[model samples]
Target chain A: MLWAYLHCYQLTLDTYTPLQQGGSADEPTVVYHENSNSVVQMNAAAKQHGIELGFGLAQTAALCPQAHIIKYDKDVEKQALLSLAHQLYPLASDIVINTEHSLAIRLDNLLQYYGGYDVLWNTLTHEINQQGIHYHYATAWGIEAARVLAKSQINQMLRERTAITKCLAHCKLSYTDLDSKALNALEKVGITSIGQLLTMPVHELGRRFTNDTIRYLTALRGETFPTRTLFRPSSTFKQHTVLPFEVENSQHLLPYMGKLLDTLSHYLRARNLTTSSLCFEIQLREAEQQVMPVSAATPFTCATAWLDLVSLKVERLVLQQPAIALTLLCEDFEPIEKDTNDLFSDRFTHLAQKQLIGRLKAKLGEQSTQLPALGNSHIFEKMTVYQAQGNGQSYGFDAAPTFLLDHPKPLSVASRVCFGPLRLQTGWWEENTQKQDYFIAQTPQGVRLLVFKDTESKWWVQGVYS
Target chain B: MKDSLSLFNNHPNIWRAREQPANTSRFALGIHTLDEALHGGIPSAGVVSIACTTGIGEVSLFQQVISQQRKHKLRVFINPPAHVCAPWLTTQGIDISQVLIITPDNDADALWAAEQCLKSAACHCVLLWSKTMAAKTARRLQVAATHNDALCLLFSLASKKPSSLPVSLELSLKAHEANLTVDILKQRQGWPVHNLSVPFSWTPDNHAIQWAIKNNKRKVHSLHSVS
Candidate 1:
């Protein structure tokens, strides 16, 4: 049978001492229950001076003057238990939460799922530890044996099959019963083993012993136990609605574009999953249902990209107007993961590149940030300006001349400084395209620029080298 | 020059072809095809400014690098700003757990946390888009990216210069109605400036990325190569 665990309980000073408050400085907090006589704390103190729990408070104080006491909190214990319970829910279906800060789920069903029971238990224990709650208790084969085995000993949990079952059967039920009378009842029939208890008539024991003992023992023999349902976290998924207009023709879909973008973008950001691609849908009110899906060149999880994409579709051919609705559905997704770095990536790193880009974008807006072109072309018609994209990648050349005026400028004539006769011909194919004189001239002030004269007999400084 | 040279003498009637396809990933892509154009996917550890105005396939290019890393078994950290999403990339067939993202937000805290992440040794690359970074600051980030062995792919929303941020690959994207151009302003090793238009697309679930592997079309696409 497989092992299932819902939570774990760790021992603390409160569990050991019903009345002890905080421990000495530099020591861990002591566990104590309020005003209880059988404090594990007092018992230890009594050993020092031959005094115990039955002695009066004055005697106990005389025996151990440094003892500090505190009240126990079931709520705190439960909160801690619940934190662990949440972690174990994914691995098991039937979780039996126990009183001493541990839980047991039916393990018979989990053996194959986990490759083996031991692996499952270790995995569960590891996950709980990450949350800062120690897991010292566990059980397998159902809560029956699991209840009695919480923190009994590591060897008990390590046993195989019947040995493990026998181990649980022998452990004390101080946690499950949690009261003196129950403790008194189990104190000396001399046998606390479930195997031994099973030999006795259950009904007779139910009549003679406390209900808690009867119930605890009954559940130990693979019986059904009552439990409450726990909620699982929601998975990331999204859907959008379409407007009611009928699509008679392409012009009618323009109005719905804005709303569609809003819906898709909202869903994506909410789950932190951006859509690199989406399928746009349109329905005709009168025609038989036709499911036409259109995907973007890229899956865009951003609103602006969604807007731009939809605008492109509409602009390409105005979607038919009077269309019943335009709906966007992202059929696929990429899960976002936490960052973990590679140990052997490049060492020639560019630090703060992201921060710099983010800052520039935040201040200047993307359209205005232009990369200075690398060239010294000195003619208004010969200089070029390129827009930017994803990383500072400049748009490759367009139909415009390979080189254009970096900035179109008024021609300067400084006593006919002759620019080299760089031949530019635009007239071979197109009429009236004039060739011009291009020169790299250095003014006396150290201002070096590429200058050119146009067919119109006008001169212009194209660009500078700085 | 300590360089391996292949000089194809101009034999007027020569029609010889190389026996095996050489790994022409001149830059990191190492695929001689795209490598000849993009030097090793913008270099390993440096601040690169990739600007896209309308439609230069900037995001697609980023995807290519991420795809390469995943294929070679490396981690990818992406921080896509809130405004521009479609063109934002998530492809490249990397394991979801290997790709970490800093959700887009306007506050400095989010970006700062992202910076601390880049300084770490847990990731192979860190890509970010900031609408507010300044010139000198961009240079400072580049320095950090170098120290950590992580490539910092920056999307500049602004065009100002702080004169401090030196970059290996400065690309400006120009997107027209249909045509796209990527002009390289600076290159660290080869051509200081050039422009190339490469077609790009993304499958939501990296289906193409994975298929490219199964179909053994890896030279053209490197995304889902399982180690």
Candidate 2:
């Protein structure tokens, strides 16, 4: 059972590069843990200026005054590690994110499929180099042993138990998972190296040290295996990007928003899914955060199409404050529907119609376009309804006027009646009853109208034949 | 001189009127007199401008043509004067499912929506009701309709004199008693016809109207007996 461990020592620095502003290549950059207030990672330029790890902020400033400082976030580092693991998932199936900056993979099962260890290593290195992250990797008989060797920057592959034990002997106690108390206790006893600690009997050491120390020694020696949760890709797509500079205009946010959409498109295509809507949460500099939702008439997985719709919506948006950050979230995903087309059909009319509706809705409001529907009502106004596509019923009616006025106008002039005194009385159950005698009237201009006289003896023109 | 003349003749942007395609498909207007006057019918794919007023049976005159053109295809209405009654459209044999209504707030959006719908090639016909339109905008709509094989009907309020616009057909409608008077203001390949009468059945004899009249008489007779 060979376990390969990878440690991303400069994870915070690597994750910060994509989000930082355009800075000079020679400028030194350093990331410090906010809680500890000590430098965790630094670029080569800072090292050249005599900066070291664990240096306090004041000390680093005194060393390299021109260095760029960034606060380290554990969650961001974890997310970056998870993304890296997802990239390596196809190459190695059994992967465990052992720590915030390290992962362990069981590679013995995959050696046969890759035909040898060198090809697998080449493939893994190629993928890691493509991401441009600095990493240290090592392999041993046990996961804990491999992790210790990787953390100590001993980059090698070992399959024999003797070789792994020989390498483990040189690793110091500080690289192990021992607490500071255990380290101090071992130091007092003159045991500084893992080689010295392993030579002692377990029962004898059990009397000298705590149970946790003994367990750590036993796991490092491949006596017991630690249970670890394997890494699995997330089902939903979400990306949060911190803008290097504040954007005042909504149009300027497109380039940043477009990058996030491209990532989402890649994720969706990898999973063979499509989404109908996306919600963008814009973090403003001073005002409250705004959530802009862009939806498509049909499910889509292409980035350019979504970008077109988003640009149209963003063009009409009014920005209240400068935006400092942006988060894109899409939780619901649907299986891509296979489109069936007839061989003789020349035009993609259905897709074109959906695209037209989506464009109109993006420019105008969502409720601007509707399909005509019929309702079950006696009132002319209530009988015709306009609703969204695919949700209305169609019922045939008798002869009626072509156009109905939204508000009936009062009949002030006299006109000759051509047809009926047809009476319509409805809405009794709701207590808003109506009774009217309707007629087809023609004015002197030869324009025919649908007129009605209510019980109050007032005449109203409801519609026109045209 | 000969080389330049050939170059001028071969230019793509220069469109000569006599070079217009002659065998374009036509949809019958369903009016005998108007069909005869048009030689075949309305051009299936181009701009047709009509100058008329509301409540003049102008919509009724085109009801037959719209229904016939909208078979298994979408029809869009951009900024109509009033709410189009679905029941009336259904009674005229129009598929209500294929009708789309877009009510834009301003005329600019209305014209834009019309052009998009025509260019999409998904719609069979587009109807737009606006007071006035610029000549450039009309030409754009005409080009879009011709290229995509879609029909655009521009309805404007009738003026005393006609304005020149690059449209395939232009007609002025007047409401006569039980008939619509159509005067062909312009046509692409035909002479202008004047005062062509097309009759419409405004008041059809139906059982629903007859039953209502009889019911009203019964109510009046019963009231008189009680008094």
Candidate 3:
């Protein structure tokens, strides 16, 4: 029944910082929520300047004028927490994103893999520190108790329920999940520490306060609280970024586009899916938008392959106006089984071909390379049509020459007929009608050709049978 | 030079020039006399150019190559001057199912398709028809074919004069009376061969054609009466 809780105290602040841009970004930062009228989070630099969590926004501004304040976005914080949960998903199966700022994972299965609880705790804290994120974590026999201990800033590992009970006994009642009115009433009755409230009779507490207070006390001590919804990854990814300035050249927008691609890569890896099409929209300053789509010949999961294709497409674009922002949207994806290569297989050759074809299509147009496919017509011109690969159907028909002339030329010299009086005069319903008798013939010289005579008795060389 | 040889004898690990192995594995050209002239046949990689004043036996040569390579890999034809007739190809025992025809609008696309198909290894043979090509472009196609172990055959409607292209084999075909005479101008590490006469035949049986015409006439008459 051992469970672990991870609380990212500065989830809102980290979501707004450009940490992946790889430059020095250590500044006094705070996320101020206007609707809640409080400072939701602050980095250490802001804390050093006397800015604290839960302070009024105006009070924080007054206390620390040097703080870099950003408006808080709850959706960003939730997405960041979801991403963090996805990263920790391989470590455990039953992961619950408890709130916008915290996650809870059952750790019984993870302890066996990490060898011990001490090593797991050290590894988790070390990774969080390396990611430049502020977090507090604790493990207990109950998930709710672990969450309460984490919120109360008591970072320790409790093996037994009694140890958790003992730890909660010393803590004050302010850290419980009970409502504020219940806490105020409890404080008025001289019950300060959790031990005092636990020592009191349950009926007496129930008589004084509502049943919710007694229930809260019970849940804090690992009695109830079992209902939880496990976190599942979303199906689609939509991310956008506004450039710092008006970008006239698409090459300059690559770095900003890179950030969105990183987020998309993480999303794809978490769900084990690959995308075939990606649509990018650039919002230009001329009151119009440019929609560019990059598609792959085959479904792919590698992020660099997709990025290289997108870079080539961007390089070939001729922007009509300066762009102010860009958005990347990908909704259609196919689930793919992970590839397992054998020892004697030429796996790289196939991969190299796909990549080469993809790059060539990106550089040249899609129609530059075509494969022959059977068309649904009996006429010579329409019998076999050249189409892009995977875009046509195969139809069985009569025998025809491997090459036909682009234009049928009038032949003056006579030739001996070898095979065909195959008459083909069927398209009368269309504007351009043809009525001709075709023959496969060879001249006195060694050239073999396909000759046809129209209704006007004019002989023409349709194609050479070479 | 003697000291160097002694040094090589003392230390076998020292690097020296090794003898070039003879290329034995080749794709038979399907013509017995031409195969003998070619020592065995064409190497499975590199370029073979057919230079001619007029396109006399070019189509027949293409048909032979296509049918031969059809069983092993995809046969790609890039930008022939006319539309390829599939029925004739299928009649020559070429598998039309494995044949892909690319119709590029210009020479650049033809060259590009040739290079890409050679490098992809998806196609074992690529046949390109172009009026003219730069020496650099021809060399690029040669290298790509050699690197990927695919065959490249270029049928040119130009002269057979000496050029800077590193073509492994070059043959000039002249349309003589009732037969095709092919002159081997260049062969890698082999003596030049004189004109060799070859026979060409591509006509269906008389009874087969008669039977086909009878069915076709019946279909036409039935459609006319119904209309």
DockQ of 2: 0.51
The local lDDT score (0 to 100) that residue B16 gets in candidate 2 is 57
Tens digit of per-residue lDDT, candidate 2, span A1-466: 8999999999878765655545654578898887898999988888999999999999999999989887787877887788788778878999999989999989889999999888888898898887678999899877889999998889887878888888889997889988999899989989989998778878878888888778888888787777778998888877877665688899988887887787788778878899989999999999899999999988788899899889989988887899988889999899886652344233367767887888888886766777888876668887787653354554555647778898999987778888777888888888899888998888877777899998889899998887
Q: Give the higher-DockQ candidate: 1 or 3.
A: 3
> lDDT tens string, model 3, A1-466?
7788888888766655653234435667888888988888877778888888889877887887767777777776786677676566655677888888898877777878899878876776665665456777777766767887888878777777778778877776667777889888988988788878766766787788877667767666666776789877666777666554578988987777776677677678767777878888998998789999888877677778788888978888877899877788889888875552334234544455556567667766676554555666667777666552365554453436656787888886777776668888777898877777888776776566778888999888877756
Which is the better candidate, 1 or 2, if ranked by lDDT?
A: 2
Candidate lDDT values, in order:
0.48, 0.83, 0.73
Window of ten residues with lowest summed lDDT in model 2 chain A? A338-347
Estimate, for each residue in A1-466, the C-alpha lDDT of model 1 and write its tens digit.
4344433433333222321223533222223455564343333334555554445555556655655433345655664455345445666655656554656656667777888767866776676555555444555555545545555643235436666656666666554434677656655666454556646677767766877767766666555454534334234333333333245666455445554555455555555565545666665566544443434433455666556445544544543334554445566776443321234333112212232333333333333222223122322332322322335432221112212333547756453232354656555565656677665544433333456677787767654321
Per-model TM values vs. the true structure: 0.34, 0.77, 0.74
**What are the TM values for chain B, all candidates?**
0.61, 0.80, 0.75
- Candidate 2, B1-227: lDDT as tens digits: 99989987898755556674355578887888898788778898899999987778776677767898757667888898888888888887788878888888899988989999999888889998988799999999999999999999999999997788899999898888777889999987767899998886654434466787787676334545753
Top lDDT hit:
2
Q: Report fnat, model 3.
A: 0.47
Chain B TM-score for candidate 2:
0.80
